[model samples]
Target: MSQISRGLENVFIKTTALTYIDGDNGILRYGGFDIDDLVEHTSFEEVIHLMLYGDLPTKVQLQRLKTSLNEAYEIPQQVIDTIYSLPRESDAIGMMETAFSALSSIYGEMWNKNTNKETAIKLIAKASTVTANVLRAKEGKKPVIPESSDSFARSFLSASFARTPTNDEVKAMDAALILYADHEVPASTTAALVTSSTLSDMYSCVVAALAALKGPLHGGAAEEAFKQFLEIGEPERTEEWFKKKILEEKSRLMGFGHRVYKTYDPRAKIFKRYAQKLSERSNEARKYFEIALKVEELGIEKFAEKHIYPNTDFFSGVVFYSLGFPVYMFTSLFALSRTLGWTAHVIEYVEDQHRLIRPRALYIGPLKREVIPIELRG
Candidate 1:
């Protein structure tokens, strides 16, 4: 029999306006909006609406959508308190994963088909709240539920930091959110679509996506990037540390490589500027940027053929670092943005007649082996 590719890692399985991944070229777009344009001109909520509904909303539509999202933002105090009860040092991604798992416990009775759309909207809306509250709770601050009038992006930044952000901060973070909103049906998004394909509850689908996003190589990269920064300390030490790292780690440079883009990730390009702007506010900004550029240049020179281009993670840490976000909250923030794409994909999957996503897997293990007693057979 001929070998068949099922998961189709390098093949397109479906067409979508939700996002475009030109991995070979290292470009990403959502619903016709380039990642760079969206980051420069739109809010996270606006981007979310675009992905879901296929166009940037008109003023009235944007208002109504924002209103609905804000309305759904008031999560139960029980949820907030549950997050509070987790250990302060607990991983933010793990907390989000657990909190989402527990969201079902509170809304278990509502877990049916009749409420799927409503539930998806609610999950999309409350995602920012969940992530923001977890960050606050980790710091022993009372989590702020969204105020009725706040934009989703503003409310999330305020709730997480316990103060409203400056316009510049909002723009930077909104860019970060929009940039991370989707990445062309990554593993986590695929997990979400597969779950939704089963007609599983939307909340369950989001929960499953969270599980996939918690992996070390995906959303976890930003956190790892930050950790490497801390290990490298000041800017002057960067060269020494990076050199030692390449020698000892061999093929890995933490945030320096991309799996797809051969040149540079466009998303990373935008954040590189934002991170630079943000660093100007601090004495350490120049040093950090220099270190980042050095890493990128070195990685390109050493591993360009391997597609180890500077990725989104390359500058993501610098942005979060300049903004005062804790390293561990990196993936939680990613989850909050990606909730939009997850729901959009779920909605898209629901429109299909088939509710299954069965795919063939290459089997390399013995096909007809019988069970044997370990000690006796040996």
Candidate 2:
């Protein structure tokens, strides 16, 4: 007899060199390098290179990669026209899926086996550029072009906001991107991989990933966390909010507990610092950060006994708020960064051992019975 693993909990799927996680100890690594080290010493572009190529790039290699990303950044104006045609109050995640599917329709014929890398670079750059355009279209503003001269975060912010981001704002955006770049076989990435396992194109895989990310269990934790902070309204109200939500009602603290991490999420630890540093400069951001700190403390005190702890989503929204993004854009930014990992994994899957990812399902329903004549059947 076979037993079902509900939700595929603790299932091992395939091997990867992209990322590593030790959830029990709250560790996350990309390409064998500690996340703490990456956050301190590397840029988001470097992290992207590491996830894609499995090694840190030399200065020449880095510059070449940047040139490739820059060169592939342009999208046809027809694509922008589609974005403008959508309803302005539309969901960003759905808009992303629709956009990528449209992109696949536009570029589908261009992708063959050999051009996957070029396609990957194109999709990676297009993810952010198109997302910014979607936001601009919603606002009835002209789409701003990304500047290859600036870093990816700076370029993305400038395109979305139509103004140059401050150096510090760029730094925070950079950190958020790196932190969210990949999480080993996350549902969104796996959705992309599952699509790729059948030899689908990269844009199709991206559409799959965006669809997965739109699920509540995957994408909106950080956004929900931010909403809770605003509901708490101030630092002084943090304890009351925490108690009413977590202790009194036995409800979750949204971003506090993780299915994977038994200890504090290492990414959260890093983001808390970013939130603090950034909060010092922005009064609006500072208010949310204050509530986040109190929530973290009270959450640990109340829930750590159960090995529940804050995950990466805990403070990422505070950082995003500091960088001046609207709340709806939070998960779109996640899809943008994770598209790097999605494209990378799809490439790896297509290049290696091949098989359909079909799994068996357990059946539990009515037992079969002999059929009677139609007139006699009840």
The residue pairs in collision within model 1 are none
**lDDT of candidate 1 over 226-313, digit per residue (tens):** 6776777776787788778886667477776655676788888898999999878887755677778777777778788777787888
Instruction: Give per-residue CA lDDT, model 2, range 97-131, as digits (tens).
Output: 88898899888743366777777777888987888
Please count the clashing residue pairs in each candidate, in the order shown.
0, 0
The candidate scoring highest on lDDT is 2
Question: Residue 57 in model 1: shift from native, Å?
Answer: 0.6
- Model 1 lDDT, full chain set: 0.77
Q: Model 1 residue 342 lDDT?
A: 85
Instruction: Report every candidate's CA lDDT.
Output: 0.77, 0.83
RMSD of 2: 1.8
Query: Candidate 1, 236: how far from true, in Å?
Result: 2.1
The candidate that achieves the highest TM-score relative to the unseen native structure: 2
